[model samples]
Target: MARVGRYDSRTIDKIYTHVTKKMDDNILDLLDNL
Candidate 1:
């Protein structure tokens, strides 16, 4: 397997965590409105 520069696992995990956190916050807001 070839190392593809700076696009590593840690960066991917950070992005995934950030995205999931945003989604969770949105869901909570929607639920609160109901």
Candidate 2:
């Protein structure tokens, strides 16, 4: 159970990081367009 929980958390962290990185890129693109 502990191992599964740890793996799930790691996956969530990776997904979060990826989403945030994409958001940052979008924001940069918007700024460039302005």
Highest-TM-score candidate? 1
Could you give candidate 1's per-residue lDDT for residues 1-34 as a string of tens digits? 1365677888878888999999999999999999
Q: Give the per-residue lDDT of model 2 (tens digit) for 1-34.
A: 3655657776888888999999999999999999
Candidate 2 TM-score to native: 0.74
Clashes of each: 0, 0
Q: Estimated TM-score per prediction?
A: 0.80, 0.74
Off by over 4 Å in 1: 1-6
The worst-scoring run of ten residues by lDDT in candidate 1 lies at 1-10
**lDDT of prediction 2:** 0.87
Each model's C-alpha lDDT? 0.87, 0.87
Q: For model 1, what is the alpha-carbon lDDT of residue 16?
A: 89
